[model samples]
Target: MATATYQNGSLSAASLQGFVLVGFGGGAQAQALLFAVFLAMYVVSVLGNLTMIVLITRDARLHSPMYFFLKNLSFVDLCYSSVIAPNALANFLSSSKVISFEACATQFFFFSLLGTTEGFLLAVMAYDRFMAICSPLRYPVTMCPMVCAQLALGTYCGGCLNSIVQTSLTFQLPFCSSNRIDHFYCDVLPLLRLACSDTTLNELVMFGICGLIIVSTTLVVLISYGYIIVTILRMRSRSGRHKLFSTCGSHMTAVSLFYGTVFVMYAQPGAVASMEQGKVVSVFYTLVIPMLNPLIYSLRNKDVKDALKRLGQRHSLVRDGSQ
Candidate 1:
């Protein structure tokens, strides 16, 4: 841990060379339990996301705009989950939860990049759904392969830019002495609190940027769903409406779970108790959501379920032939 030189009286006491993450502390037994739980969740999340990606690639039935987005989403979840879960699990097992400045900064950067990218990707997925439902005839033309590729690329570019600004702005602040970060990961708000310098401008800028991303993407999702609803209502076939609702419902559930926890953790006003609450909520969005996404999509979607079944039967036949 290389310490920052403090010149003048400007540097506050909270500045430090490295940070100690005092994660959800319970007794040793409790930490052990948490480690087991998180380890299990991590394994499951990776496997689940990988399975979805493989299914999407191998199954011709899933080769559509919607699955394209889903494949990307699964990839994001896999990478995002990897960013935090392994380190967190290690901290739970190790006595010292210390992270050097460079490592922490790197973690923060990737976390923000992937998370912001996923947000934009979800909005794009909603638009894909809207076009599919609201304009079935024109959907093929409107959401061509080129268009889908462009949308996906745009989300990645946007997320990278957002993260660069945020990570640079955050690490530019001086930390005087306080090396303790209360949260599990190197999140923005908790890191901001440790800054020795005035963080009003930083906070405001971060809030503005995050707010813009969240609000704009959310509006796109809402508008897409709004149009989708009107179109569904006008349809004569009940079964067709049911199918549309089913697809949208899975996406809506995912969006709600993700945005709901994120908003609670970052956007809302906090009480002293809210910090504790934020940790729990962060676990859900950061760890649990990634695991749940594949399950939600697979269970709700007939196409995925069918693909899984075919995959299983094919494997069984291969095994029997070897016998």
Candidate 2:
């Protein structure tokens, strides 16, 4: 049992050492099955993102603002997937499922940092598309290399600031009751349910901050896409319109997969018992989205395919020379 104290006429855990993560419970067979499934996904996500990063860095053809932002996005997806997968995968096989306060906070921190940054990066990508399609003449000067670096930096900054607030606010609450987190990993909603005292401030902060980030970034995407659609329609060449549409379509698919779950997870009252349903939503964004992003972009994008082909040919030539 966790040690507790009564302060301000309420219960609080003065010496709450840690929490027990009550992961998705099941039989041995089920656990093994889940473990295999998640392990495969984690491997694919890591490999795919790493390949995208290497290809973008190695290929001169991908040295553009679009690919620059994409490289950063891949980096985020890679780390974001890392923050939770290994621990959860281990727990699936091990009997001990305990996590200390500090460890959980660290997990929450990086997850929040990278995930939030991705939203901003996606919005920036939408704006990049808008400028490239709508204002072809000044696209280069407007989205110069230095400018892309600054934008990427800004996304990280935004995510860091939000994460600071979220981590501090969520972890500050006193956990007086059971120290069980009913989720696969440390998450805001599940942890909030464990707070012993009134969590009015926590609720408001979570609601307000989540709303601000999601709404603002989503607005940028929507407005940028609005102009992109108009510009694409005005293009005379069917081939040109089709190419532009195809590229923009990939971004839209990723955005929908990401924001749809976030809106459902954080946009509502996290304290509600029903929010437990967000497990599926959380899995999609954290696991499935990262694994699918590289596929969506590489398969749908002609440039990425060409770069892969070129990279393969170079490898083959080196092998033949060695022989």
Q: Clashing residue pairs in candidate 2, if any?
A: none
Top candidate when judged by lDDT against the true structure: 2
Misplaced by over 4 Å in model 2 are 1-14, 270-276
lDDT of 2: 0.89
The TM-score measured for candidate 2 stands at: 0.95
Q: How many residue pairs clash in each candidate?
A: 8, 0
Backbone clashes counted, model 1: 8
lDDT of 2 by residue, 92-211 (tens): 998878888788989999999998999999999999999999998999999998899999999999999999999988887888557889888999888888887788898899889888
Give me the overall lDDT of model 1: 0.88
Q: Could you report the Cα RMSD, in angstroms, for every candidate shown? A: 2.0, 1.9
TM-score of 1: 0.95
